[model samples]
Target: MSTTTYPRRHLGQGDLAVSAIGLGCMGMSDFYGAAEDERSLAVLNHALDIGINFFDTADMYGVGSNERLLAPVLKARRDEVVIATKFGNVRAEDGTFVRVDGRPEYVRSACDASLLRLGLDHVDLYYQHRVDRTVPIEETVGAMAELVKAGKVRYLGLSEASPATIRRAAAVHPIAALQTEYSLWTRDVEAEILPTCRELGIGLVPYSPLGRGFLAGAMRSADVLDANDWRRQNPRFQGDNMVRNLALADAVKALATQHGATPAQLALAWLLNRGPDIVPIPGTRQIARLDENAAAATLGLDAAVLQQLDQLLAEHPVAGDRYPAAGMAMVNG
Candidate 1:
């Protein structure tokens, strides 16, 4: 396991705090493949054992199974970790996703459902998983603000929201963080979103920070993925794109050999050097992978190394868009 230790960072620009590196729970339940309940639980417990004080989840993950999965441990040590979960993605009765719902009623109902499944009175951090264009951001954030008022949630956050949308949401209430897909290959945020968050004193919680395992070199071939694995749908993992991305991974692997760190560890450590305001949530169900990701906190990244990374990224820009066109349309971008 990771023996490296670093000072913990503030959760946002507020009193809440967590380890510089946090655990992202999505892979344990959904994206990677079929959810292995036992293995996922073991990883969660292991995170606590290793001082990963930040744990993230969402209501829509596993259609509630993720929260149910975390319920027992959360109840036992609620005060020890910072729990972050999200809502807004709505699913129908038959498991068909209907649409994003930031409506006041849905917000309240979602919170109640998450609370019940988690067996908790409050969520330390609550986020709108996606910005619902049909609903005004002010209206949606107003509802989230109510949860904080009711003591059902302590902090508010927005995910995949555009710069304008983030500002609109903040106008209604102070949003503690903006959760979005950000990594070396996917840098749309560097243009405007990051600047806006900094101006508002909002932390940027980057999900899929290792480019959804693409940069980690853990996945070099598409044949290894499930037929329905989410990565299969990602453009970077498809036919020609996959071939080109593998070339990039090869270069990263070479660097890893020179640096004496795994590609996964190097990718994560590069993210650590991005900025203190940015917290990456790299998810995995294996304790070994978790330890490597967490140990990124201590990996060194001097000017020359960062320049080399920038050059590599520029030379082999990822071929396709990060998400499928359908999901891409939903991002407030």
Candidate 2:
């Protein structure tokens, strides 16, 4: 168990209570760039010490290397964390995303493969990483439900799933959480997706709650990112869009300065204030950044501050799409 004290929240009505801020482990192994395993391990340990028990990873990340990376930590502290891994986003051997697979056999095989990689018997929360439009949600979730019955998975979830798909999945099984990209810059969820989750008693897990580090008020240009850094390919981080988006980041920085909090902290605190059902999984490979993000749980935003942020975002709308054209097609399925 974590020694440090922190506020905990449940995912939906399930008994899986995790720290309000979960560590998204995708960057430790893939996407962002090259990272040392030793550094990643240290960061993971520090997260546990700081009372962050929820760790998120996907099987396709690093082409299964991400789950493998967490194996050692899970082996040592199996009972101390609420580990969540996702599937459905298939990848080829060359780390190229092949397609989204939600077939019944693929679901079973994927869970088994993830367990084999993690060297674990069961997963606490298993999510369909991306909804497979090729397959019916009922058949996909039914296969996930079978995993629950077999004691292979404790809770089921869906990532980037539409509200209609969410309803369909919940009818098949008790969906614990819905992981989606939500942050200060990406308020698309607020209008419909968020309300739908709340109505159905499914907790909201906001991925990229810091807007892929844009809301952190650091990256002034896409030129700053490493050559292989995936953010470079992101529309929001390119050309004129980046210029316009920085203005929003500047506004966030101004408000954060007034509140005496880092922009990342203020951004996260804003999401936390949205409701108790929200748990933002912000990814970081550095322990310092991890500590900075974890402190957001304690950063309180008054009604006036919240109102200011609301108006600020409303006035300075984000510039570009959250993802590229192909990536955008996968979400809200």
Candidate 3:
């Protein structure tokens, strides 16, 4: 939401609607670097005030610190926005490593834990953060459908799930959205996932739409990353891969200049151009940067310019995989 509503995008199936752009809350608590809770809370409030009704978070993000962080900000306006939280990535109480779990009993308990963390009896949308291959998708989604029937969750989602698994889960219950890594560099979704979602009327929620801050032109070098920064562990951002990828970023920056848009805006605009039903969620803990990202809706792109971008990006494909070895090991697709 902005001075204007940006626009409404169909999320899953019949009757569901959300802003053209959503807010990814993962970085507000952990992963990217140390988070500024005070500033992050302000950003969340600002998002709601601007009409950004779709707010995304996960159970493992901060091991529930993210939901707890949203407690103060969402307490008064809980009903105004679509609060989407995820489960499946289980953590030990010590807050160390997490593993995927889609056991039926675990699903119920995890949802309950998320509810307690958010201080809400029911979540607007609940997603399985990752597919647990050991547990059938039917079992996981069946447990999720029960939550809907029991009034604990309004809608369901799956993150990084394969198209086949998505269809299998949809057989249990209609999935409102599929959250996945989707950016210019991460184009694998276009070949299978996006088409399957379109055919089934499931909305595509693009996470890391800014290339995880790479498309923003803020990260110029691997050396710019703090020692603890997760990107440093990413192959695409390591060693020569780091310098090689900047050429692609430079192309995006050039296109942004010609279009009178920021590289971040160009990146988001590119995703929005992919389909009307797609919503790009870029995470930010700074209010000014949040506003800038939201403003991407105002910067539109026509067909010819979009094709030009496609060709340029195609010519200068990014180097490195989107995730590190351990992280890549969990993605369903």
Global lDDT of each candidate:
0.85, 0.94, 0.87
What are the models' TM-scores?
Answer: 0.96, 0.99, 0.97
Off by over 4 Å in 2: none
| Runs in model 3 lying further than 4 Å from the true structure | 1-4
Backbone clashes, each candidate: 0, 0, 3
Clashing pairs in 1: none
Best by TM-score: 2
Ranking by lDDT: 2, 3, 1
Give residue 94's error in model 2 in angstroms.
0.8
Best by lDDT: 2
**Candidate 1 segments whose C-alpha is farther than 4 A from its true place:** 1-6
Pairs of residues clashing in candidate 2? none
- For 33-78, candidate 3 gives per-residue lDDT tens digits of 8888888888888988887878999999988999998877678877
lDDT of 3 at 217: 85
